[model samples]
Target chain A: MRLINQRLSPGAGAVLKTLPFVALVLAYLLGSALRLAENPNDKLLPALTTLADAIDRMAFTADPRSGAYLFWTDTLASLGRLAAGLGLATLIALLVGMAVGMLPVLRALLAPFIGFVSMVPPLALLPVLFIVMGLGETSKITLIVIGVAPIMVRDLAQKVLDLPREQIVKAETLSASTWLIGLRVVLPQVLPRLLTALRLQLGPAFLFLIAAEAISADSGLGYRIFLVRRYLSMDVIFPYVAWITLLAALADYGLDRLRRKLFPWSELEGAR
Target chain B: MTALSIENVWKEYGDQIVLENLTLEIAPRSFVALVGPSGCGKTTLLRMLLGQEQPTRGRILLDGTPLPPEPGPDRGVVYQRYSVFPHLTVLGNVMLGPELQANRLTGRSFGAARRALADQAREMIAAVGLAGAEAKYPAQLSGGMQQRLALAQALMMKPRVLLLDEPFGALDPGIRTEIHHLMKRLWNELPMTVVMVTHDLREAFTLGTRIVALDRTRSRPEELLRYGATVTKDIAIWPPRVAGRATLYDTEHPQAQDDLTAFASPAGTTRQTPSLI
Candidate 1:
């Protein structure tokens, strides 16, 4: 059969799905083995045992001075900042986007401003945020909000605008007040789109969070990764990087599942 | 019963004109089907009646009073597409009108009130033949089922005027017939005025008691913008089909059924009745 026409069995498909991952792991193992063979102590590529030992020390054991589990603490701190920033951004985007999209006066006033702001690189505002908000949790959370909120707002506003005008007219004829139209009509439809926009913005949100943490944080996943870099501890750095990647993947998966469960209509064929 | 009057209404968009010097008096409980060629401002006239667009030159009155500057519960509308809220389930869509009207701020009711509303909504849904699909979203429905749901949603509000802007224009011939039956039944049962815009003349004859046509007198490119559409023909169906009157169509008269079957068939296959014109 032609390659395009070939269909994989379920078991074959599963194996094929894992092939690239298996290849990657094997290649990493081979590199580590080769590096360790040349030097008894190589910090570039730690062996599996060294990586496992680093994980145990960071996760199972508490920090001797602070008496806190470093891995859990870092994860909690990072997750808290992410939740706060994204939550605030979600609320603002829902409000501002709906207003700009639905009301002509608001659109005339704010659309241009939002367009301009969305163009400005959010990372460039990091120092400004720090200088204004101070070097606390607020600054880190604000960085994520500033980084993701404008794009989210723009996306949500466009989504609202793209909605068929018929629906709005129908709602009006149903005797919905402007406020009720926003709450019942526009809000329900935009929520799933908002979740989708958030999923797309997660990578950038994390980037800003980490960048802000790396430059000026006492504790976080980014803080730990940057902190251990000076010691040339590839073992810790490697595990932490892997852990971050796993967390991001898990978050993305969870968000997608949530969107499907909450708004199954969105997943329907031809639904926008 | 509510009567609507459009007094020399003209809708102009800057230099371009859409509707010009339109004067119409629609009786209470009348089914007025406005038909015309595309871009003849038929839908534009419907929008003006619904208060979505204001007439630049004249006033529209409902029940001897000026229409509210905006669309209100007094007027309900269904469009060719997007008539139902996609996010809402069938039951929710039907109940939305009463719920929003009953509670001003939250648009919700609680406990016994909510249950009562749900029961009413379920009854309405069932009336439109969507009894078992209460939990399904609009997107889950076929185009025909969705139009049924939209009909139920609009009728639940019990508006004084029901405006249909090609509500079944996108449906298949078979489904359109089904919806036409439901629409006739609803008009017979309800005490509301209905103004429907359609491109299909057969559909207008099938459902409307009065048929009105809009067209431009001058079609020249230079004159297109200079002349807006006006009512070219005003027709009242013979043997006067009035609301609350059991029409032959609703009674399943043998001849009416034959006409419908002919209407459903491919064009030019069978001779249509003069009444169907």
Candidate 2:
């Protein structure tokens, strides 16, 4: 039924799509080899066996001082904070953004202020947050919320505003009030975009979370990285940083799956 | 009795005048197709009738009473796009109005009423030839099916006056004919009053019982803004004919013209064939 030519097959296309990631790994390997050839004692590019050993020490063994597996404890702590911060930010964005987007009076009142707030560098608020909220869990979580919520609100509000005006007018003809329109017409359309906004905010959210943790934390991946910087222990730091990257990637993949499962229509519309 | 009345209506946006000194009263169960030049205010008038935009001066009335400040079940409209809710299945979209009304009256969805409403919606969807596709979403439908779904949804409310703004503008000729026949059937069967605005002269000719041509007839540019758009030509194209009844008279009969224009203004100008836009 089919003839095979020199052109790419489906399997080949899949491999082609992942070529860049493979190339990145190869480049890192080459750089590590060259650096180690020059200086066997260099901490800048630790050997792979040394990094594997460091992972075992951090992940398999418990820290004698704290009697806890450091890797798991750090992962759990950072994940909890990330989840809480993102959840709170999403709630704030949905409520405030929908209100502002739907009502003209509210849009006029808060839209400009939101724009100004988004423009302010989120890192600049870290010091103020630290002084006000104390260098506790509250401030670190607040730092992520402050860093990501405004931009998310702006994005989701624009999505609501961008909905076709005809739909609103049509809803009104059905005798739908403002509240019913929000519930029936706007919410379903906005929900998938919320997932998209969450995916986009992941990078910045992680940035703020780590920054907050690095500055002051007894236990976190960021804290360990900074604590080991004095000894230039590239083995532990590299593994920890790679772990964070893996976690972020997993979060993104999970969101994409959820969006596909929940709102399959989004994919169809996008194909257009 | 008059179904809708527009008295000395004027609409303007900042400095540009859209409609001026427009006066007309539509009697019960009349199909008036409005055609005009591209920017000569047909849409503006439709918006006013739909209660989406109000005239800067004068008033619009329905059943000899002023319309409510907000759009409701009393007035129904179908636009060119996004007419049907995308998230709803065909049956769900058709059932929205009755379900909403039922909710308002009872504070909950009654089992019997919902079943009765579903039956009614299914019958209407069958009338529009969308019976089997009742579970399909708007995106899954073709453009023609989507327009038919919109028609079914709007008709479910059974509004006093239905406003259509080129609801079939995107349809192909075959589907357009199907819709035309479907619309004529619905209009006659329900005896509903209709106001449709279209860019196609053929459509205005085929569907409109009374064709009213809207245009700025002013020759002078300065005074043009004064009488922005008026009923330059109002013609009786077809005598009102019931589906089962035989035709009584031709539109050219002076008595038929006189009868058609009774509620419309006494325009000294006779019906003239409109130059195509």
Candidate 3:
């Protein structure tokens, strides 16, 4: 009976947790059906049909066995771009965040600049970025930095500031230098929070990356979406959007799992 | 030689005065406890002595040199809250000071100093009864364990003096007593100039070789209250025996007994006077 009760408890919790997602899916389906029923010739049905056809075309190749490899290659190219952009941003963000967080006067002086720059949308800066950096990978990567750096810097700064006074005081009494205190005591405390922040910024980074690629690049999934959109080919556009969403969700889940693995003491899951 | 001296120290917070013309001297290898009511400037004085804050009117000196502008390993301080670094393992926190100073002092790489500092940290942790917990993080430990880790970290540097501000005030009475005994043991094992501030009078009397009482005036208005009593190194000088006699007489007085009987039934007559000894 005890084992049965334990088994039933988790099932109930899972259902409760999934209720919101179920509601969202139901709402989307109902809204689409209503729109199609009202206007039989509406663009919505054609867009969905085009999306279905695109998936079918991608699923079956001239040689069915090679279709999987083609899909894999395309996926890898998009994933590789994301990984590079994210890796560069993480390195830059961690370094800048530590520097700004450690030095009080520097943080104060640069806070306004970070705030002002973060307010400017990434897409709005595309033209200026293109003029300055050109329409290469540099421009897109630069866009990702401009879009993500400020958020990371702000989150990391706040996290550092939020550290308990006692921890710093403990270090001070031990005659620890500023660098020692930062490297040993402060960085370890801040890293887990920064990782969580990076995960939160992942969605925005992808959005900015896609926007940059769509406007200026000749390759990338974003570029393909734009090409299909020009001819009103919803088939290609819908599939790409779904692919990006799925990838974003997977990446976010993986990062959250990593965060838990690293800092088991944190109560972030309860926070969510 | 005087290990620490505070001459005519005055501390003010903008307009409000926290300490006024306070003076103290601590001899080497002595344990002194500073007892006071809340807001009597015990913490402020400790901070001033540790060089965390500067006195407004006077000076604090260590071994005839004026206190430095900021805290250093020469004076180790343990706060009421266990201030162990939550991120680093027990050994990491303990070795941090020596490793940092070694690099600056000798221009040696951190790798060169790591093994020696780690050995020292391990020894200190074992001394503090945390021998097996050296690899554990602060959060993984209990409150008592965390405080012990803080003690180990502070003592690992082998500071000339140790300053503690209500180090056991946040713990439950049982844990507080245990920590107090541990502190006394550590003090006996390695004699260094020590100054501690505590609200618990029993703690002060139990652990202190010399007790400096603050805010005694409010407790007794008619008699000239000794604001501070520095218990001499000789234990015979403690006032507990005399104080205990007076308390017993007061409790046994006819009027006192009558009042107690009025407050309670005849069953309370068996109550005895509380002992501070």
Model 3 Cα lDDT, one tens digit per residue, A1-272 = 67666554787989989999899768766866787788865554353555576777654453275535333455565666677777777876677777777788879888678778779887788899999988787888888888887888878877777777666766777767787778766777787887888888888888888888788765677777776687776656667777888989998998888887887646422211
- iRMSD, all candidates: 1.0, 3.1, 4.6
The TM-score measured for candidate 3 stands at 0.79
DockQ of every candidate structure: 0.76, 0.36, 0.35
* lDDT per residue (tens digit) for residues A1-272 in model 2: 35565578899999999999999778877888899999988888787898999999999998999889999999888888898899999999999889888999999999999999998888898999999999888998998898899999999899999988888888888878788778777887888899999999999999999998989988888888988999999999999999999999999999999998987766665211
**Regions of model 1 farther than 4 Å from truth:** A1-8, B247-277
TM-score of each model, paired residue for residue: 0.92, 0.90, 0.79
Considering only chain B, report the TM-score of each candidate against the true chain B: 0.91, 0.83, 0.75
Q: Candidate 2 has which clashing residue pairs, if any?
A: none
Candidate with more favorable, higher lDDT: 2 or 3: 2
Model 3, clash count?
Answer: 1
Candidate numbers, best lDDT first, in rank order: 1, 2, 3
lDDT of 3 at A94: 76
Q: Candidate 1, residues B234-270: lDDT per residue as tens digits?
A: 9999878978876544444222131445444454446
Local error of candidate 1 at residue B15 (angstroms): 1.8
TM-score for candidate 2: 0.90
lDDT over C-alpha atoms for residue B176 of model 2: 76
